[model samples]
Target: MQRRARTYLTGVALAVMLSGGLTACTGSPEDEGGEDTKAGSSGAPDSSAPPGRYRTLPEPCGAVDLSTLKKLLPDAEGAPQGSSTPGKGTASGDEESPYEGQPIATYDTDRRAGCRWKSTNSLATRNLTVDFERVVSYDPAVSDDEQAQLLYDERAGQAEIPTESEPPADEEGGEGGDPADEGGKSGSGGSGEDGGSEAADSGTDGKGGGEGGGDPGGEGEKSDSGGGSDASEEPGGEPSPSSDADLSPRTLDDIGDNAYIDDQLDTGDSGVHRDITLVFRSANVIATVTYDQWLTDKRRTPDSAELQEKARSVAEELAADFDDN
Candidate 1:
């Protein structure tokens, strides 16, 4: 009887210990889950951070359109198999300002085009010398003015001034006839409407004119006059018959110093040998894209098939700035 009682007591002790352990585990489940949830939430990226889109250049770099480029500036006669012009190559490097406050256009020559494949050349011969500027090409079909505007817009931090502003006011008589008016003349004791009319007709009224002092129309006339003067002063006056400067073939010597490698390709017949180089100096940037092909010595039309194919590929790949491979 004594031995059996002792065994029962031991069983009771074991059962109680197991129950206590189970209670402890069950009670801590919510806390453990909450800790895990907190950790996951803390690890996520911050929602308020900026998207970081501004890290790239304001405008794309190393983009080109061969056909359009050809149309814009036809290579000069005997121009090496590329888009550069002969003497123009030195223009970019020359101290003379080719484009006011800007370096002349040139192709790019860099270390990238070593004899890994077929051909090699450098735009440094073109003489482009602007730092930090990048090359951006567009369809030659775009008007020169349009291209200029496009380039202007692509540059980061460049702002366009709103052309509209408050017109200058007349000081003296109402708007039109006041002689004492700061702008010109003012009207005596005329109605506001009459003063406005006079201002419109005479262009500028005398001083002393009420709030509607200076001739509103006068500003327009002055602007027109200024515009006319500018038009007359232009180098040949009356917009140049051709927006394109001489569109002729160019040689390698015509690029600028700031030139950098933009892109390159192997083109032309699989067997024949020919090399074509295209250089671009846009704004402060200079870049070059080269196309190499096997050209035959026979009397033949320029390698259109190879050039066209290569040009098309270049346009597709470099139409937008690409990452360096």
Candidate 2:
């Protein structure tokens, strides 16, 4: 009777285990459609996948303007730099090199490296980053007033003066004589003997020509005719006053490449190195160049204004082109 009870109990346990496996294989109707059930239960409508290119993003490319990005990020050290401004901005380290002039749009340094300035609204990922180096060079066209301003405000000081404000175009007058020359000749030839008498009478009549009052006619001839001749002798002067006072852009070659190299050189025993990285995401790829190496070089030795400008320009140019795709 005890053996029979044990057999019956064992059979019951096996039957119970089989039933559990069958239940596992056939879940509830809601479980058959997981996503649909989730949508219905949550009370949220199902959202289709985003479009191909911009579908993945909240907005299309170029949605964000350059100015907006600039506002979002503070101009602190380690912050991206550009070529547009004159002096350097306050980034990570000390503001040793301050920006001092009007922002430049475009410039070229060496044959291999030329900078182009542009702003974009397109973006693949929600985030974008750009880094550029400033190009530095001395400008021969900068006026003394500009130089003085540069001493105080480096960024404003480095601006490129426009063509209109610059010294007018050097002009050469034609060989043509002055119109007044005809009047003098008429006066001289019209009266010969009367000239001396007229001179004496004119001198007496005149209140003050000083010593020349003795010969009025002769004094008048000397004064008037001499003036004409002097005026004729003068050369054609500079062009009309320009509307633009900004200076022209200069390159490293223009300012002297040595100045650029010296600024990037290190005084300490540490070797020169560049810090750059390549970033990759699902939608885009980017090459990021940093100024950390530049700062390292500067720590060992100070760079010249020209060199600093070049470095700034390079950084800025890269920032401007940070996004190729």
C-alpha lDDT values of all predictions: 0.28, 0.26
Residue 215 alpha-carbon offset, candidate 1, angstroms = 44
Quantify how close model 1 is to the true structure by its C-alpha RMSD in Å. 23.2
**Candidate 1 structure lDDT:** 0.28
lDDT of 1 by residue, 1-325 (tens): 9999999999999999999999999989988999988988876543323221112222111223323333222221122332222221223453431111112222332211111011212110111111222322234344322332233222100111111121234433354654446332222222222223322321111111111112212211100000112112222222313323221222222233211111112222332222333333333232334433222222222232334334334433442343331
Can you give the TM-score per candidate against the true fold? Answer: 0.25, 0.17
Instruction: Show the lowest summed lDDT stretch of 10 residues, model 2.
Output: 220-229
Candidate 1 ranges with C-alpha deviation above 4 Å? 2-7, 26-31, 42-63, 76-155, 158-325
Position 261, candidate 2: lDDT: 15
User: Which of the numbered candidates is closest to the native, going by highest TM-score?
Assistant: 1
